[model samples]
Target: MERREFLAALPAAAVGLSLTETAKAQTEAEPFPGFQPPGVDRWERSDVEAGDRPVGASFGTRSEVFGRSGAAGTSHPLATLAGIDILRKGGSAVDAAIAINACLGFLEPTACGIGGDGYAMLWDPKAAKVVGISGSGRSPRSLTLEAVRSRLRNGFIPPYGALPVSVPGTVDMWWTLHGKYGKLKWAELFEPAIAYAEGGVPVPAVVAYYIRRGMTNFARPGMGIEELDNARATFAPGGETPGVGEIFRNPDLARTYRMIAEGGRDAFYEGDIARAIDAYFKRIGGWLSYADLAAHQSKWTQPYSTDYRGVRVHAIGENTQGLATLQMLNILEHFDLKGAGFQSPLSIHLQAEAKRLAYEDRARYYADPDLVDVPADWLVSKAYAAQRAKLIRPDRINDKIRPGDAPSRGDTTYFSVADRDGMMVSMIQSNFRGMGSGLVADGLGFMFQDRGQLFTTVDGHPNIYAPGKRPFQTIIPGFATKGDQPWLSFGVMGGDMQPQGQAQIIINRTDYGLDAQAAGDSPRWHHEGSSQAMGEDDPTLGPRGLLRLETGVPDRTAAALAAMGWKIGESDGGFGRYQCVERRMDGNERVYGASSEMRADGLALAY
Candidate 1:
């Protein structure tokens, strides 16, 4: 029988719960072969048997999305739709991004939330240049390096706990963006997310997968976790996370959003929400206090750039690891990558060698410029990158790479939007280490970010644990321009893999001549276990770390990399997820092409 016919024939009284409610109960349903089961419809990879693409089409899993007036791309289908809705309502790119972010916080809270930090790179049409915004939050006012040391385990701050909690800057980020460029009302941005939170949304397969992992991690004992009851109550009702296609609701988050909508930035930073967070942390012996929240302020930073094939590629400056991309690009700019061939072992080795070298500087010099005398200008200098690039070899890994002179600077969610007026926004937000610090405020439904954990306890280090200092961050937004037009607003999501992925995307499109979709669809690599950004001084990790390759890479390339004295491993889906919206000129009219990550539930659309 059809679903409608079955529903009409069987009354609600026959079963204790409706189909959706049964799915939400987090139990396996009875098996009935050839029958459609509730909560089982998932977004799986398309079957290869569907037939290959026509000649000259994208080698990507899907065709590039095109739009003339505007475009939106995000990690989730719902959030992208929310962005499109806002744009249809006469909203600016910033407004659309704000709406998408708010919705993403509820739809994919394991990756981001209002209880986290964010950074953005904007392609402002009026300014005719890209701008950067640092929405990073600071450590607690009461915190001292010694007090933080007292809570350390194995010389490192616990990744998920009260000790790692920081003041969340995401609300302030929204307000700052709105005040500068928003077209719709301030309250309008929260409508879609608030409604979804109250009425509930069916959990997607990918989101459910992450929620399960994050919730289990929180439930693990001896992880320094405290006051987790609130988190558990909010995310995993009845001691379990919602299943795929199960309707999940968060009324507390809805109430919180409503409060922020009415009270503006003050509500989250200094009002009732702040008081609740302060009281909860105090009860749990945490560092964050009402004062920390009240004093928190987001900054407007400069977006640094370097030329690659004559295109201006921008990255967020100081206190973030964004400059690594510019430095990497600068180093590779001296090479002939088109001749080297895409995914060649030579190309991979060069990029990986440059990455560890750039990361060496990032670990040593990148810090809050306000606190440390970072070598800001020299870090992104072509001369400096060129000097460092000389150490890399074509046939071998540069295991001896280390920091030269410099200044210094996880799961994350990234989205990009473009409006009809020619403005583009590239924004990235995160609750660090998946679901943040694993502690929720008394009445609020969101978890605070664990960004404070990224700080090392070593005294005098550029990124050491200190009171009222913003810790090092992983999330970054990317933007690029061609001549005078807004070219690209994009970002790649992953801890430490962001810059590497951004570089790959740029090379893929600009040099390899791939379309928007094909650029993201191409196989990638990640280099991990390098000298630490969040580790103690003189970490014993050897220079030669494992280089993980995506499945699409050939066995011959893997063999070749191993022959070069490098350890090769298979990817565990950490390569990175990319999203982009590209703008081009088709004669007199403006044209757009957008791409979303095939590895994720995201989609790109234009109108």
Candidate 2:
């Protein structure tokens, strides 16, 4: 069939077409100028880290673990160990996760703490399906859009300060998760974290780096912060972020956790903690109040999914950008990526283009479902993706692509936990943008999330700021099932990188036949300059954005992409940090494999 004829025959919403490899190859747009060498990959070099690998290891690989009872993959080794300890004590995955998350507050507080919002996806063996929850908080009841608009200095919410602070939801989410899926007492879960908080643990390299960076940014002028004394006194007490291996303690946090342990979730939301937060914000002239904290509630959400190569990928729906992953997967499902080869120029181009296309819709549709009527069903449907996929020309980038009448917009910590009984959890929590708003409530020991900064100030946008509204969130956790069985629990941490990085994980495992560790270990590509759903007017973003490749990607691929109208650049470690746990039945026993990102101070352990 001719190029036009091939596309014509495919139905607008059909899926699982058995297109041949040769036919798929023909779909590639003729290379721009047809002269750039297909840039070859630099897979191995003696000067770099690798020396030897296990028989089944993938590139830049580490030892992936397998276990029959349980596994935990966390950004911090200490946090991972805490989770394992919880599992050993007969805790469920949710229980282990609560423990791990609590530990991360002290160990990796630059990314997560109780003051942040949280989102999660889980596989409940008893229910035999995936479950999801949205722990995002509402803007203060008294803070109107006019109030927010009057406060914007740069015509957008700044990354740090009380202006962007929202009533945190992580504490409530923890109780919710525990109430539904936990097998251990809630107070017991915080025991490990509380002890560690009081005793002090040595700061790791990655957290230390973010601390220095976050403290510097928080201290910068014009960040909308009325006070920096609290933050400086809380985190950088010595006038700087703690150095790696330096012992760090948060006795304030310890006392706070102790209160939560005794008072339940109410301790944070309805009790003394909330009062303290309310008082601090009032003192600082911020919006949040005790009424806002007391009124906060996080809801359970039905996760959205897409079929990709026989696996069902699941993520939290709107109010978050998670659905964009499903949409991207839907578009890429049309191509014979397996034939193009893993990490090849053609494959990378296809992924990048798919991201650009889906994100256009992201800028148009994703919003709080309670307030906006997002066509969630149509957005991720195979039909919508099939129609959208046709816009791409094999050789050229589609700069004119716009939203298909659709819409959305952190830094975050993502972790995975699985227990012996088959329950699995994918959890991501964050304070947003380098250690959150620069306000730490008196004696509470955690910074309020800067997530409100993600709300676009564009007039009449669905995601515009409003009292009692949830801002468009940046963190998402994901789960996947294969052949109706719990398959994978995974997530990637970084604002905007979560969805794309996750899509690549599925593609790597299914299309490229990579094992769990290698799927995460392989070099990745990240795209920059997507439309910010800002209703236009902002000048920096262009029609087609820049494509950034990791160090291991070949120059040939970059050359090929540039020839095809892509502007290529190198990465600044923003690709994302991934963690995952995969389950498979080996003969009669169920076994699990865990993988953690090499880019962060993370670890994957099984037992």
Model 2: runs farther than 4 Å from truth?
1-49, 406-409, 532-539
lDDT of every model, 2 decimals: 0.85, 0.85
Tens-place lDDT per residue, model 2, 481-553, is: 9988999999988887888999999999899888888888888898877755442223364777778888777
The TM-score of candidate 1 is 0.91
Name the regions of candidate 1 deviating beyond 4 angstroms: 1-51, 55-59, 406-410, 532-541
Candidate 1 per-residue C-alpha lDDT over 341-404 given as tens digits, one digit per residue, 9 for 90 to 100: 8888888888888888888888887888878787867988888877987898888776677788
Model 1 scores worst on lDDT over the 10 consecutive residues at 42-51
Q: Estimate each model's TM-score.
A: 0.91, 0.90
lDDT value, candidate 2, whole model: 0.85
Clashes of 2: 12
How far is each candidate from the true structure, as Cα RMSD in Å? 9.7, 11.9
